[model samples]
Target: MKKIITKELVPGMVLADAVLTPKSNILFEKGTILTQKDIAKLTFYSIDEVLVHDNEIGEIMTISSLPDGQITASERIKQTKEFQIFKADFEKCAEKFKNEISDLVAGNKEFDYKRLLAPIYELLQKGQTNSAVFEMLNNLRNYDDATYTHCINVALASNILAQWLRWSKEEIETATLSGLFHDIGKLAIPEDIITKPGKLTSSEYSIVKTHPQKGFDVLKNVTISIHVKNAALMHHERCDGTGYPGGLKAPQIDRYAKLVSITDVYDAMTSARYYRAPLCPFIAISMFEEDLQKYDTEMMLCFLENIVNTYMLNTVLLNTGEVGEIVFINRNYLSRPTIKIKNDYIDLSKCPGVYIQEIL
Candidate 1:
């Protein structure tokens, strides 16, 4: 069995796994044959994906058009409540972890690896799918205290990227932990500069740039893999010899650092900042495209495929005030995807007049 986005769902396919409603009730049993009506039913439930026999997935010749109206008021409420649950739990974990790390650094004590990683592992497992984790990240913008939350968000993104890259279990764990500790040096920066509502002076900016090296110093004595330690030091290093500290080129940068750098930029750009408000994910993608030399293109492409393309079945509002569901991604242009608006499949890449205003 293989999981596929609902946009790719077609009639005559058999469900390899049971389809459950958002309320956890079984809507369709495993091995059940899917028809147009069943497909519509799943769409109405805001079901994103389903598992089908691997052989059956690619056998469909046509994709039946379905109107988009998946989310209900109740589902919105449920999603909000779900976000709250995750928010509460994340806050608790962040607080405890932050305190523990502070104590570990201040007292020169050994890192409590088990205690430090358990909550993160639990959170990752709780989300289950990459889409669910990204959804949680989108909802997290509703809360404050971005410092601790940013660490958690980056770690989640890093782990997801690691999984997408098909890394080993130990490598994934190290990458996740490395993301959590990447910005540890920021803790040493003065609170006023860290949270400054306005532009910083040249000296302050220079201090801010020292975070990577300072973070490396903090983790130098810690009992973690060298890759993990290097992640803290090199995450800011760019591919074209333009990053920070040593300004190492692509070949000089560590592989783990390259992976973490993508996620770090993604979360940092999408998250609200003291200098400016958060940009939309699409805007962030455009930013990456504008400055391709500053990142690992291969890793960035994989991240876009995993993180951005997961919104395949999402409803979006266009600049023309029309609503549509994203049906396909344009391989040549990741941001300008094909949208299904009623009976028409509008390819944004070809249509120069209209653009997506927001993802509904």
Candidate 2:
């Protein structure tokens, strides 16, 4: 079986795995052939791509990285190293505008074009890594100020989510920058409010709510595109009209803003915060699944499906202390799946005697 990106999906590919949504699960039954219409339907579900099994996995050409289900943590670590190097090179681009606040203020001038181009070149030069960059960012949280790191982490998560939705390369880049600076206005807020380490007062919360507008004001003079500014301003807006700044609903919100909103919530819930300990990925995914109506259903499905498939190759130890590689996922119960030991298969879904304790 080979994984293909949605852009590369074509007719006549047989699904090697099942496709799922927040409300339903559709297993294509291993050998089922996919027609163009079937492919189109899957695309409507925000499926970036599907794994098709043939004599062997065939390559599907795509400008963006294809989602491969068979990626390992070690491989993710390698990708993280590559990103670190890219970040180091990219930071240099910010040097030219060091003394120019206007250049920095202008969203366009702040980004290092060379650095922006490096990662894509590297991704092409090397092969696409199976996992998204967010997984790596999640592991890098030992820095002093957690808020800034959290913002960066949220941005990475948002960009990965947007990429999974098969947005154009230009849109993906703009979304990424927007995610990175969505909270720039927070820079102007009082530090005490930003890091209160306790419940915020209604007055303080009001101040916090002004971040979107403040961020837009800060970048108003910058050369950054309107999409980026909107992302910063509208990320906090929710579909239920419960979000801050502007209570925009469904069609009123920008696509990028919606994407950032989901990513922001996921990162915040899964990270250690002043109010609570971090939630595990499985739990976080479940929570997101429960609230799918609050987001673009298709995008939410894509995010959940990608995350489940991405971690399948990692080594995990069951509650029974049995260690093995995740070789198969049960469509009905994603949290539990079949594991492959030395020479046998342990279907956690069917094996009532055993269970997964934790992922190592």
Candidate 3:
């Protein structure tokens, strides 16, 4: 199963998913083969893409890249046209903080706490602005350096969650600070261990688990609130008491720590790593659902409903050699949704024999 853009739509190709409108109504169904007339009608909907299962070719069709000559000056300008200026400013702050992370871990006597908190202050000017900035940075252009980029991404996501939870202005600032510095302890660990392309040995894993305590020790003397300190110390702890450093369970771990933990796992799962390719957001969400016991149920639900909803729309795909668009979502069971292809409706919740084999 695969996804192909509208330009690739052709007669005889089956839909793996369903095509849906914003109103949650099906436009087509799974297993419905495309026709020339159907393709012509799709343009009216402003749909630029569709997922199709091409059994004859043995793959799903997808638009791989932007078209040639499409990278105009206007396009580049649009890229920099931020929906929220504060978010852009916050990213600059994150970048500056990243520069001193190594020095903090090396026990530098000159590390400055006020300077470290500057980004957090900038991120809290307005909750809505901060949230917009967080979203913008999450979709920011990638850099070759994965560690720095991953850290920033995690910080942005964590900050958004904190804002959504309606933490006090002061608490939101501390949460952002904690998230930005949560992985600072990694600097004390060997670079080889941090960037190893293979699985870690048991001894290496033990060293890796020491990051939380290491981060806490580095910030112990720093002039910051206790909320910030605790978040850094317990971001790796789980609700199920199955996480590392200290296996503190629910209630034992602070709410801020739990919030950071969820964001940490989400960023790690979605970012490309030395050992594996980045997982798709949908797949990562599913994985989190399966491990719901490991996180705060209310927070996890908020993250999914509020944050993820923005990205889950109009996604086309193939399911078991058929192509379709997602017409509706089953919040309780995200894996099974109503899909529309050409002219059919697939009620996955009722179709025991059908399954989504791939994401186009």
What C-alpha lDDT values do all the predictions have?
0.76, 0.64, 0.66
Put down candidate 1 lDDT per residue, 22-87, tens digits, no spaces: 889899999876744456456545587899987664233232322486663224634676667776
Query: Would you list the rank order by TM-score, best first?
Result: 1, 3, 2
List the pairs of residues colliding in candidate 2: 6-48, 106-222, 106-223, 107-224, 108-224, 318-357, 319-357
Taking every candidate in turn, the Cα RMSD to the unseen true structure, in Å, is 17.6, 16.1, 11.5
The better-scoring model by lDDT among 2 and 3 is: 3
Which residue segments of model 1 deviate by more than 4 Å? 1-81, 143-145, 274-277, 352-354
Error of 2 at 324 (Å): 5.4
Q: Residues 1-360, candidate 2, lDDT per residue (tens digit)?
A: 788775466545767887765467763456656643345445435466677775542333222221367554545665666666644533342332232323444444454533443443343233244364555444543324345555555656666777788988888777777776677778678889998865567899799999999888887766677877888889888887767788888789888888888888777766665433354465566556556677877777787778778778767666455668889877656666789988999887687545553344
Better-scoring candidate (TM-score), 1 or 3:
1
Residue pairs of candidate 1 with colliding backbone atoms: none
lDDT digits (tens) for residues 236-292 of candidate 3: 899999877789999899877888888888787655544233444555666677679
